[model samples]
Target: MRYLRSRVVTFCISYALWLTLSFSVDWQHLLIGLLVSLFAAFLMGDMFAEQAHKWFSPRRYLWFMIYVFVFTWECFKANLDVARRVLNPHLPINPGIVKVKTILKTESGLTFLANFITLTPGTLSVDVNREEGVLYIHWIDVKTQDVEEASRIIVSKFERILKEVLE
Candidate 1:
């Protein structure tokens, strides 16, 4: 019963978002969108239900938004720094892979951090070891071999934000 209620709520919320963002609420379009959303919700019922609880959490949503904004600002700054280095004749890129241990316990949290790393310029999450909770990231530049420092920066700048939203 709880599952079914969650599914229905998820379907309605998704449909409403689609309606507000995509199409007008004419009878035909509304019916079609509702059917499609319902089908999708049914197909991914478990995922929807799991995330639906988080969606209703105002604190998580607020923290997620704050994280996104901060991430965008950081990305922009990194882009400029990378561009400057690239355009310079000296080419100061010290590309290498660094292994950083991740503190996030959940798969979703780790995946989010990996995706965030890849999305930002100058670094890419190449591999993740679930057993050891380690992430191998390729960085365009490395000033030092201190993996702990790298992990600290990542956790302080990004993972903390993710934890606020996800944990």
Candidate 2:
């Protein structure tokens, strides 16, 4: 009963957002759109239930939004730095892979952190050790090979945000 209610609420909110973003609704069109959304929601019932719980939690959702904003700002700064390096005659490119240890316990949190690292311009997640909870990342311009430094950069910025969201 709880799952059903959550799913319905999730579907309605999603449908409303879609309708607002995609089309100018008349009475007939609104009816049709609602029907289609309900069908889709029913098809993805379990997903809606899970996602609805995650998505509706105000604290978690707020942190996630903040994470995205901070990440975007950092990416922008990193892009400019990279561009400057590329344009200069003396290209200070220190490319290398660094193995960073992960402290996040949950799989979802770890996955989010890995994806976040990859999405950022300067770093890419090369491998993940699920058993040990470690991440190997290829950095475009590595300033230091020190594992602690590298891990600090990743964990303090992104991993923390992911932990807040997922855990």
Candidate 3:
């Protein structure tokens, strides 16, 4: 029962993604997408998270859309900051790998957070320690060495939204 449900869920998501990416409604494209999605779902459905029902939540999708805007804004600001530092010789960058704590328990949530951090300019996600619930991030400007302070500065912006969307 659980296996069948996972496959169905995976197929739905895979087919949706294919449609979005292909951006074609033609019967030929739809047929190819269906075949590909079915093949993907069949091979990887069992690997889907146990709490796969979360994918069906409308609230999660809303939060995810909000998160996209927040992420884009953060990236834009980071780009400007990095550009300023690059252009100005007086601005000192305190570069260091700082450890920040994360409250996210799920693997997908953690991965999303890490990827977001890495994607943002002037900061890079060096590593994630799941057991310790910590992420090692290399920041262009280290504001504080304190764990809580760093987490608040670096992780809080994305973490809260990610918890709603993925956790």
Please give the lDDT score for candidate 3: 0.89
Please provide, for model 3 over 13-122, each residue's C-alpha lDDT reduced to its tens digit, 9 standing for 90 to 100: 89999999999899999999999999998898889755778867899999999999988988898888888998997877889999999999898999999999987867
**What local lDDT does model 3 show for residue 32?**
97
State the displacement of the C-alpha of residue 33, model 1, in Å, after optimal TM-score superposition.
0.5
lDDT of each: 0.81, 0.79, 0.89
- Scanning candidate 1 in windows of ten residues, the lowest lDDT window is 47-56
- lDDT by residue for model 2 over 7-88, one digit each (tens)? 6876787699778876876788778778888887777766544545566678998898999898888778778877888999
Among all windows of ten consecutive residues in candidate 2, which has the lowest summed lDDT?
47-56
By TM-score, the best candidate is 3
Candidate 1 root-mean-square deviation in Å: 2.3
Report model 1's TM-score to 2 decimal places.
0.85
TM-score of 2: 0.75
Deviation in Å, model 1, residue 13 alpha carbon? 5.1
- Which residue pairs overlap in candidate 2's backbone? none
After TM-score superposition, the amount by which residue 112's alpha carbon in candidate 1 deviates from its true location, in angstroms, is: 1.9
Give the per-residue lDDT of model 1 (tens digit) for 67-112: 8898898789878988899899999889998888877877778888
How far residue 105's Cα lies from its native spot in candidate 2, in Å, is 4.0
Q: Give me the runs in candidate 3 sitting further than 4 Å from their true place.
A: 21-26
